[model samples]
Target: MKKITRKKHLEMRLQSIPSHPKPKVGLEQYTTPSVIASDLVWNAFSLGDIEDNVIVDLGCGTGVFAIASALMGANSSVGVDIDEDSIALALSVKDKLNVDNVDFVVSDICDFNQPLDADTVFQNPPFGSQRRAESGQDLKFVKKAISLDPKVLYSFHMASTEEFLIKFYSDNNLEITHIFRYNFPIPKIYDFHSKEKADVDVIVIRAELK
Candidate 1:
């Protein structure tokens, strides 16, 4: 497979990935936009994290991060999500694209016990802004990623929670490194949403577990 060297091309490729067909309100499942996903994956690739590495995407909705990582030269990309329907769609897309290196699993993040050592992990978990989001759900994802023992972790969070999350990561033994900010677009998928689409400030924290 040819490696996608440029971020622009990677973004273009990722833009074609389909979002969740039936987004669950309780899960707070929103598709990670292609622009942000590509930017983060490109940075990981540039940092010597992607090529020939086993990548994992936690809370993967429709496999954006996993598929993009595979395209960027990951040896294997595993996407884990609790939604079986989303996993089915992701598998269909993966088969359609002939991307043999990516795989999807249906499991709760806490219940996932796969023993494979992951080289890098990407997670765009819930921001805990909605009524259905349990408190510290994002922290749960952080802990699960650490359990995988990845060389590096790229996690998304509400930018407003930066200070608290920094302390949380430190408490969990993750050495702070780079922080990437983006305007995450949230489409009006639910009835509560008033706007057609809105951009929320989000941050992707890059860290290495000690």
Candidate 2:
């Protein structure tokens, strides 16, 4: 298979991937837009982090980042999600697209003990916006990614939590190398969402182990 070396081609390929069957509101299961996913993956590749690298996507809802990385030439990719339905859909999309370099696993981010040996981790974890009890769930994903000790990590977080995340990463011995801001689109999937689509300020932080 010819690798998708261009961002536009990668985005086109990502558009064909399937999304979550039933998006869980509590899990903040919003599909990352293809454009955004493409930009992030391309950025990682440009930084020499994706091509021929072992990549992992934590909380990989429908496996957008993982598949995109594989399409861009990751040696191997693993997408781990707690939702079985999401993993199943991701696997189906992988088969449909014949994306042989990526694999999906159903597992909680907290309990995941797989030997990742990953060079990079690209994840869009829950922003922890739904319930008060789940407010800091994003941190759990960050902590787990840090524990894996990948060479680099690209993670999404609410822009409002920028300060907190900066501190959290620093404290965990991860150095923030780049931050990309985006207006993430959230479609009306829950009863409480009044608007058809709302833009939430989000930031993708690229960090390296310190």
* Candidate 2 clashes between residue pairs 3 or more apart in a chain or in different chains: none
119-143 in candidate 2: lDDT tens per residue? 9998888886554436877788888
Q: What is the TM-score of each candidate against the true structure?
A: 0.96, 0.96
lDDT of each: 0.90, 0.89
Q: Superpose all Cα atoms of candidate 1 onto the true structure and report the RMSD in Å to 1 decimal.
A: 1.1
**Pairs of colliding residues, candidate 1:** none
Q: Which stretches of candidate 2 lie over 4 Å from their true place?
A: 131-133
- N/CA/C clash count, model 2: 0
lDDT score, residue 88, model 2?
Answer: 92
- Determine the C-alpha RMSD for candidate 2 after optimal superposition of all C-alphas: 1.2
Best candidate (score: lDDT): 1
Per-residue lDDT over 1-210 for candidate 1, one digit per residue giving the tens place of the 0 to 100 score: 676778999899888888887999889989888888898888888899899999999999899999998898889999999999989989988887789999999999899999878999999998875655687888899999999999999999989899999999999999989999999989999999888998888999999989
For model 1, the stretches where C-alpha displacement exceeds 4 angstroms are none
